[model samples]
Target chain A: MTQATRVHVAVPNAPYDVHVGEGVLQGIAAATAGADRVAVVSDREVCALHGDLRRHGVDAPMLEFDGGESIKTLGVLEEVLDFCAASSLSRSSILVAYGGGTVGDLTGMAASLFKRGLRVIQVPTTLLAQVDASVGGKTAINLAAGKNLAGTFHQPHAVFCDTGLLGTLSEAEYQSGLGEVIKTALIEGEPALAQLESISRDLGARAVTALSDTVARCVTTKARVVVSDPEERGARRSLNLGHTFAHAIEHAAGYGRVPHGIAVAVGLQLAASASERVYASSTDLGERIGRLLSAFGLPADLEELRSRYSLGAALTANALIEGLGHDKKGRVGAPEFVLMRGPGDIELGVMIAEEELRDLLA
Target chain B: MTQATRVHVAVPNAPYDVHVGEGVLQGIAAATAGADRVAVVSDREVCALHGDLRRHGVDAPMLEFDGGESIKTLGVLEEVLDFCAASSLSRSSILVAYGGGTVGDLTGMAASLFKRGLRVIQVPTTLLAQVDASVGGKTAINLAAGKNLAGTFHQPHAVFCDTGLLGTLSEAEYQSGLGEVIKTALIEGEPALAQLESISRDLGARAVTALSDTVARCVTTKARVVVSDPEERGARRSLNLGHTFAHAIEHAAGYGRVPHGIAVAVGLQLAASASERVYASSTDLGERIGRLLSAFGLPADLEELRSRYSLGAALTANALIEGLGHDKKGRVGAPEFVLMRGPGDIELGVMIAEEELRDLLA
Candidate 1:
């Protein structure tokens, strides 16, 4: 992809570009001209897919780890540290995360820690990562306690979102990305929702041209919000409109069993329903959300997920509610929920009381 | 002790106050007025010395971990993450790192990771931490590969350097701080060296009032350097002048065999000697440096360290040379060394040859 189809991710002092296109990875070497050494941290599969990244002005040894949610941990992070120190990766060196969000999160953290924040470039391969994880400075590794329990806000020096990688993704993974794209569309207000509506079928059909435009739109929306509130004080929390419930669903259903984007789709439906019921929000966004989910070929019906995960069961409900309280964006006791008001508006930091939350599933 | 001694550390985006006084820790509650909750991470020793920080506006639970340089590891950092999660520490929550440099490093890292950075306040108890680690936003945890191999730069919301804490230190522990004090004095140039000369007798005798002014001057000097180059691009690397040889000496002597300050005292002596040799422009700053070390009650003789650590041996020389290459501020081949030009001036980033380093002890 060309730099022309790029969005400037304004992270205040550390602004960077998120380039979306085909053959974009080739530009990484030029982008990291000042880096004395470039170290690529990717998974074995991705490394196989995109041959040795050492040719890209990288003298240091590459660190390839096992992929998936299970691999994101402090143990793996330690291994990353050992590789860096052994390779003698200095502050002048740059770490290029050449995989999906899981690899990006792990590598980003290693860069931040190794010699107190080295320059990092996010080369997101998965659709879920390219649109969502690329722009935001959120880098994390899951702990036994919870997902994203150990992480920091380390913005990448630049992000290379090459849509060419989508050609190799499985149908399930591709659909997973559509879930987040739908979520982003809802957050972007009416026009984005309309654009998403027009492109959903093309996206479902895997049209290459449609993929590029969709990725750019989602990235632009995310960049605008993150720039306005990088630290998630108020406005940025709106981006987590469905994430409060999504995290709980992921935890209960078990991570990776159901992809994060799919869970976010379900959570957005939950948010629309809750917003309509609790606030009597003038617009009935739930119907529109359901249609969007269907159009994107996602699991629009909660009945299937509820039955599968047993949402009515005490254990599952408790896990969901407990997860909400531990949601990093919300306060400890008073958990914040983002409720929709149709189109471009969503009320962030709306605290849902225990009773309302208890009956949320019902 | 009063607010007059406070130094404002201008760290670009994250400016903070370093309050130094007798009972300054008492004002912490007022300082963190906007904090919804304050959770302290300190060892039993600091807790006993400072008492429960809850009295200082920390209503949240305290996370007390094992103390020492050994405690600076990812495993302990994970435990810290658990504590923050269990405590349900939101983005709004404040983390008070109470103790020495080790505690500050670990806690500061945890603060940066937990919810992508909480408002961290550095309450450094040791003299070394107060004068040095307090200003720079350098937070780290050690890995098996090396010391400070894993870390990130997370600036504290504020730093409370209460000289009152220095009163509780053991003779060795108190003297450990003097190493950094002397190093700072040298970095500050002739005026600070003169100040150290003036106060050395009172400080050597363990007079408390003299400790306050010395700590303030060192903090101010560090603040000026860190504010200009927080990431150690150029002038900031000068801070590691003595540290390069100091690391080698420490590794050769074995950690804790020669305390950090003692090694620094020796390292400063080495820098002065090396500068005199290589530069040849004429200045016996080494003699003045030796006297300054004696006045500060630090080990002035490299011969003592060399004899004790068996420096003439291949193992020690190799370790010292190996350690110099790994110096954080310098590249692999071109290791940076800070050398003295005159009283208030110093030449930084001087590359010493291998043969010179090999025969350094001889």
Candidate 2:
């Protein structure tokens, strides 16, 4: 039994706590202690595997759905809301989202839209969700125009990252989460970057202590960023370091074709390479990140990613550029990229021309 | 030309100005100054009559729909988002919500969800929207379960309450706006209540100065309430004075059948009567409010309301009580009602038993 690490997120008007450890799912009881009613919204597989909340002393009705990027749609969102209505969930009720990022996103969105807003407790079962998606208030579902095109910034009431649940993840799924871990390390500066590099082997082996410590660190870093800029007006854009390109890739490749974090992994490399071209920073930075990603069984670049996944004819520079046009972060002119001058030294909203981007991709 | 009164709403993270006066729609250009592009979402009839943004120097594309309670649905919300995509609205672009409360609510919800959020400038054409709905950040669309069951608290960048547009409203529509005015006065306390009493005749005659001053005062009252509690967690619930019963009435009466503010007018009387029974407050208060409603050509009680509108079989006491069960503001036990002790002396979240409520309605 590993000691649980707690990270406090101080988003304005909606502060919450995140617990990370082997058996933190038990904390769901404490998180929802006073809730009039607790309803669980979860991935179908996760519910089947670990569905009994009564074992943890939470006697709540559960609503399960197939979890994937495909489920992140407005139609699915309405179904979740309908379930909430049927469950008689009031503003005083709490909704526990139990699954990976897709379940968390869909449930978080449902909680936000159901009766204006309902308090939500996130119990993330995947490493990617544990480290990143479940911490921030950014809850979204996809529209036909783009991914996460329609959503809200409704922060969770509490987050429980039970790393014990990760024991069931497939090898590819575990590596997918490490992609975000690497992205966070790059954004967190030299010491964190070095720490991730040192633990890359242990993380690859899925060591309990290594996973717990890394999840706590990623959550701490994310909490700090979210507190400063909860709405992503300025500094919060730093968290989108690899996300702009990642979203474009996901859009061009067709949603659900490639894992989100894997796309983010390739996005990090693209951002780093573009940083070298735009800022003329150390070329060594990209190489170092690539090596770390490779050590964790993740794709280090687009060419490697293409070999691993079928991106089809959509994975073109032109298609990606066109996809970039629909990015939520986009403004009046050219889409701004979160480029790195170096680790911890990130520039937000950096405009890179289409011609220059095309040349770089070529 | 009457001077436009400006009220600053200081909702944290999103603050904007509300301008109230005749012909204030001309100020639309200044509110959306540096926007990459400006797009209009408006009521179809309003657009045909006054949608020419070119005269105001805001040459933006327009999207119009039939505006009413029927349009406040997830389906219509999706159409609005699709139009935003079709119009190429980015985060930097401005969406001008130009119509009555329906248009404002739909457009504001779309603005909040489109690409996470887009800046919206509200150009409220209806008197009800001018005083209340347009100024508050609460944007919602109805669900099959209840009215405003799905929504967000996305504040507008600016509000332009063009009193000139009220000239085209039907007699019932004009009085509908007065219903909310009466509710605001009651919650605002003595001075506001007396002021409405003094100017009720001028307001009924649609005098320009009377309308401008009254709108500014209502905005000031609402702005103060919203700034203190942006998310309706505590003090803000008082703003829902007649709204609990009002929403129930609208729900039972079938949406689009009853004017929202008119339902609120009768709701105000019911709450006043409830307060008298529960708190032993003055019986004079209910009578005083009734007179004010009559002066404004509004329904003062349920009997008056039923006489004026076809409530069918839905306006029964049991049906309304059932409707209260689905209110977003409800909790675990009994649904809380926003009761009043006297003018400007409002009580929030007062739980009245089902039997007691039935007796009061009887």
What DockQ would candidate 2 receive versus the native complex? 0.67
- Residue A311, candidate 2: Cα error in Å is 2.8
- How close is each model in CA RMSD to the real structure? 2.6, 1.9
lDDT of each: 0.79, 0.87
lDDT of 2 by residue, B1-362 (tens): 58688899998877889988888888788878889988988788886787566678888888888889889878888888988887888888999898899999999999999888989999888999998999878899887777888889889999998888898898888888998999999989989999899998999999989999999999999999999998888999998998888888888888888899898988899999889889865668888889989898888798778767866466888888888887778685467899998888888989887888887655
TM-score of each model, in listed order: 0.94, 0.96
State the lDDT of candidate 1 residue by residue for A1-362, as single tens digits. Answer: 43238789878778999988877777887887787777778878876876756655444578887778987889889988888777777888888888888999998988888877788999898999998986788889987767787787788999988888788887778877887888888889899998888877888887878888899889999999999988777788878878888887777666777788888888999898888778765565778878888877677855656654465453366777776766667666777788887867888878777777777754
Q: By TM-score, how accurate is candidate 2?
A: 0.96
| DockQ of all predictions against the true structure, Cα-based | 0.68, 0.67
Using DockQ as the measure, the top candidate is 1
Model 2 whole-model lDDT (C-alpha atoms): 0.87
